[model samples]
Target: MSMINNAHPGSSLVLLNLIDRVLLRKNKLVSRTELLEVLRPELLPKLSPKKKKDDEVDEVDDSDGTAMRRFEWNLDFWLKEGLWLQDDAGMISVSSGATQRNLPERVLELIIDNAKSQTDQEILDEKNTEPFFRAMTCLLVQQSYTFMGGETVLPGKNGSAQKAVNRWLPGERSLNLSNELPTFLQYGDFLGFLEPFGSGYIVDPTRAIEPYLKVVFASESKLSLNIFIERLAEKLPLLDGGRFRRLLEPMMEELGWSPREVHQVSPSLSHALVRLESAFRLRLDQASDDNSSMQLQLPEGKHRFVSEVVYLSEVNA
Candidate 1:
């Protein structure tokens, strides 16, 4: 689905070439000539579609200028996607807010809000991966296998998770378990979002992470805390809010709040909820500062906490 030429330089190639060129110059604005040199393979037509002898068709023929037009169109697409920015002088560079890890290599890891709005052609163009899937992976990773001195584990087997994934996906196209699943798993593992657990894989849930957290936090749309918690509970019924505390502790720790030193589960749960409230507040503050249109506001309340016993909507209200 090349929005530009549709034939030559498919969307994937155009995107990869653009990223390669941008990253090569350290994400700086490269000149048109520089981009042309980098994207020559895709830009140049491999063969003439058809030799046109008719004078009228030849006069209006944009064959010779196809490369330039394709480049311009693709650049505009990226700009609209907020992946790139272009100056009035015609220089192009990565957008200021695209600082979620070394973008060129991990470009696909980006999680955008309202990802479902993307056309089917656009999804296929971007390697057939879903943005919501990426957000779910981030949430999975945020969960921990152990808390304090006790072992905490996700409920059900890999089969159960796979079935849930199939049911959760919005579209009609079924996931290719053989080819696509492995690729998705490998990519998440390569990005350090997953790790080997006993016989299967689990999310890493590391503390010294911010870029990944930003990606997780960027899911402020349908994948908000209330929805996420509900989904997790549905998929893994054994994982109650108390178990979720273990999953959320690292984020709490990152926000300068210490996990309760007590080994009791109730106190730890309270501490985790307190930290989660702080994290939500901080995210809201950041959103306000950026003038983001994200509707992640908490309802009017004296106390706001993330707990399974209390529904998020009720607490916010």
Candidate 2:
């Protein structure tokens, strides 16, 4: 089943964080029932009905059932996608690969890995693309069209973003893009890839990439702008020149998609780097010649060229 159809809005990350916390406290894999028990109190309040008046009697609440279903959907999706694992006895724990990294990093890594593993056909399949591939498609569409003065207003009930997404998909598939688009937006916001702007969101991965600075830079204190982009693309393949972008290139071209620009840095990425530099997380240095300098797109249609990037310090979360 599609995550859009079965999963609750913003529940994936919430469930993952809760699972991690419970596992940490228990110090071992938790049985399904035990995990549910721990999650019940945390989830019910949000799902339960609120009384409008103090004198009103509480009706029979099915919130427990609702909470359980949501939890199961999130758990199943994560397990099937390898973000979470289940043992022979059905004991649940976060995947070994997901440990050690911060929560956002873990989720981001899992999303990229899962999306990359899927074939183009699988990604194009409406039934198979929910949550991960669909979310990625939405983000790309947001960057390509919405951020560039397109008609898609995110977080709007008008469904402009949904229409934009449907246009990117193969014409043969007649999937009704509705709730899933909004859900993807929520996930993007929570993961720090999309920042809320006015009534919508601006394509900004600054917060998303912040936690991974150490991992991205590794032992190197400085890197050429091109090298930094390469390293970042390796970790987050949804960026410019990333594997996902390359994979979608042929299909996108077949569907009459054109490159937004010939520049090495995308507008969204340039925006993120500029923000990072302003936050004192990194330093961007310009060279005398434009040969190796990457063009960075700034606010108000301004542009800055930088040839090298030096990691200063990690921004405290």
Candidate 3:
């Protein structure tokens, strides 16, 4: 829509057609809005044969609010799924789901294709990651991989009461039996409850490790190390390109930090920065595995942004 309004060579439907023709084969992102934002501005403007609109001057207002011109004229298309959450404090941006952009390419594709088949176990299971991801692209199983219970085949409907519970006293028996139990009725084991989310139950379906680089480390220790290392990396001419995060990768591997730090900070950080007692350990030989066959209790999400007193202007990365 933006491209078309800008004087693009085609209609909105034409832009969509271009997606299947060129974009899909490249393993590119599928969303039209996202693609427009990502596309080279020079080429995109060619699609629209219109002159650019002159910028509107800002209006004077004590309180911050959308100006009449910007809202009424500038907004080319309405955001259908846009949401603004207003609380006692102020308004904040909210999304439909899974806004994190740094997720791996395969994971991104699977999720974008409306397949959330990757399980919690798969997140931690490095060995099966390749095969599981390969299966996601297959026609028979992409969506099915996430749901083995045949959710895609048939429309969901209420089932017989007999399937609700495995056993019945006398009157509950019925002849209309498909044999397979209802999805809703099947109660997977409700074990220990994890941490509760702040934005209420709807958005936070389930809480787990944060992300790849950070999730692998205990919240406190990871932040602390990153903080200590980040400052050192910045101040000292230790690593070139300044992306020296992977430089410490060997040390992290040798120490078997994640497993050894399980549910708690490791000895290095725990001993120096965090004074908490060491909460995990392993036999001498078992520490070789990267997964460490162990893990620690992840701390709250916000704590992941640990900063240090560095010379550079206050930075957030």
Models 1 onward score TM values of 0.36, 0.78, 0.15
Per-candidate total of colliding backbone pairs = 0, 0, 11
The numbered model that scores best in lDDT is 2
Query: lDDT per residue, candidate 3, 235-278, as tens digits?
Result: 22111112211333233345332222223322222221221112
Model 2 gets an lDDT of 0.64
Tens digits of lDDT, candidate 2, 81-107: 666678898987765544544666666
Poorly placed runs, candidate 3 (over 4 Å):
1-84, 88-216, 219-317
Instruction: Give me candidate 1's TM-score against the actual structure.
Output: 0.36
Best by TM-score: 2
Position 122, candidate 1: lDDT: 51
The lDDT, on a scale of 0 to 1, for candidate 3 is 0.23
In the predicted model 2, the residue pairs found to clash are none
For candidate 2, which ten residues in a row score worst on lDDT?
48-57
State candidate 2's TM-score.
0.78
Poorest stretch of ten by lDDT in candidate 3: 184-193
Could you tell which candidate, 1 or 2, scores higher by TM-score? 2
* Candidate 1, position 135, lDDT: 29
